[model samples]
Target: MNALQLSGLITAVATAGIVVIGLPLAWLLARRSFPGDVVFETLILLPLVLPPSVVGYYLLIALGDAGPLTSAGVHLLFTWQGAALASTVVGLPLMVKSAKAAIASVDPALENAARVCGSGEWEVFSRITLPLAQRGIAAGTVLGAARAFGEFGATLMVAGSIPGRTQTMPLAIYDAVQAGRYGDAHSLVLLTSVLAFFSLLAVARLEQAGATTPAHGAPAGGV
Candidate 1:
């Protein structure tokens, strides 16, 4: 695939992975308050507050060929998959936090109502709770995708900006700048900015729509 297409694929895969893992974790954190929950939340969010380079460095030590992961024959550094891994790690916190907020916004009464109606826990979550919070999850997915697309420092440290391979749009832009290819860098920056802006706008619109929609009685799945 071309550079742009490959980067798009990477972002999609990373976002999907983050959503799949982070959503359930977010639900657990949001719905089931427990001891050390705050600590666990903070740990999940560390990547957001920490420097990307620091996260990348740690990933490298864990996943690089010469690192401990090598003993298990798991190599991640300097590959496209490594870039996706870095993106997923950095994006996961955002996804989790957004998902948690979304879940929190869902009324407990709705869930209780479903439970009272003989809905199982899984049924209530899949049918009632998830639909109610779908907007938030959608917003989270968009935000996570945008973050992944723009990720640079960590991806660079672990994946090295190899054009048509490991180089994503952000990395490509940086490389263009470093090479004094101002026009190319400017084009890429503008393109990325536009895409990020539109994705955020779409999420905001979804959130608004969700807020405006009235809740109905439980369907087959409780939603």
Candidate 2:
């Protein structure tokens, strides 16, 4: 596949990975305060503060030939899957942080009411918490997908720039620039910029909706 198609696929996989991992973790952080909470959260969010190249180097070591996954006979080195993994790692912090804030904003009393009505934990979450917090979670998801779409340094280190395989848009742009293909580089950059702009705009609109919509009030039909 070409760079655009490859990026879309990687972003989809990365988004799914983050949602599976991040949602439960975000709920735990927002609902419970355990020992070492700060440490655990900081570690989860470290990629946000760390340099992308540094993050990529760490992934390279972990996914390389002699890595633990190799010991388990599950090789991902220099593959498109490796690029998606890198994107997932880097995008997780945004997902968790945004989701946590949204979950925490939900009133505990509302949850208690659901339990009083004989709702199970899963029912309460699905019927009450999720609906209330959907906007912020959506915003986080958009931001995470955006980050995954434009990922470069980490994906380069772990997956390498193999054309038609793992060469995502950012990597393709880098190669174009390096090969003195300014036209290709310019077009790719413009495309990436447009995607990023829309992603942020979506997030902003979600945030505005969340702010204006009352947290304590139920939706029109009620859950």
Candidate 3:
């Protein structure tokens, strides 16, 4: 696949990973304060503060031939899947932070009311919490996707830049620059800029719409 196609694929995979893993974690952190919760959250947010190359180095070791995953017959080294994994790691913090804030903003009374109506945990989360917090979750997901799409350092370490193989848009741009393909580099830069602009614009719109929307009372007719 071309760089654009490869980036989309990687972003999709990474985003799915983020949503599946990050959202629940976010909810737990937002709602429950247990012992060692601070430490646990710090570990989760480590990648955000650490250098990308450092994160990449750790991933490379973990995914390399002698790594535990390889011992388990799961090979991710130098593959697009590896790239997606890197993206997921780096993007997770943003998703968790944004989603946690959004979920926390929701009134706990509404959720309590749902439970009072005999709603199960899943029902309360799905019918009440999720609807009210959808915009924030969406914004977080979009930001995570954008970060994944533009990933470079960690992706490069785990998934080498092989054109039409594992080369994502960022890697393609790097290759272009090193080869003195200025025109190609310029085009890729513009493409990235356009994508980033649109992603931020979408996030802003979602936030604005959420802010303008009126808060509702307890769900009618029971959950």
Give all candidate RMSDs, comma-separated: 3.2, 1.8, 3.1
When sorted by lDDT, best at the front, the candidate numbers are: 2, 3, 1
- Candidate 3 at residue 128, lDDT? 88
Per-model TM against the reference: 0.90, 0.96, 0.95
Worst 10 residues of 2 by lDDT: 214-223
How many clashes show up per model? 1, 0, 0
Give lDDT for model 2: 0.93
Give stretches of model 1 more than 4 Å off.
Answer: 66-68, 211-223
lDDT by residue (65-102, candidate 2, tens digit) is 78899889988888999999999999999999999999
Residue range with the least summed lDDT across 10 consecutive positions in model 1: 214-223
| Predictions in order: lDDT | 0.87, 0.93, 0.92
Which sections of candidate 2 miss by over 4 Å? Answer: 218-223
Candidate 1 global Cα RMSD: 3.2
Instruction: Please provide, for model 1 over 1-223, each residue's C-alpha lDDT reduced to its tens digit, 9 standing for 90 to 100.
Output: 6557768988999999999999999899989989999999999899999999999999998896667877888877888899999999999998899899989878899899999999999999999889778888888888998898888899999999888889888888878889999999888888888898899899889877766665443345421
By lDDT, the best candidate is: 2
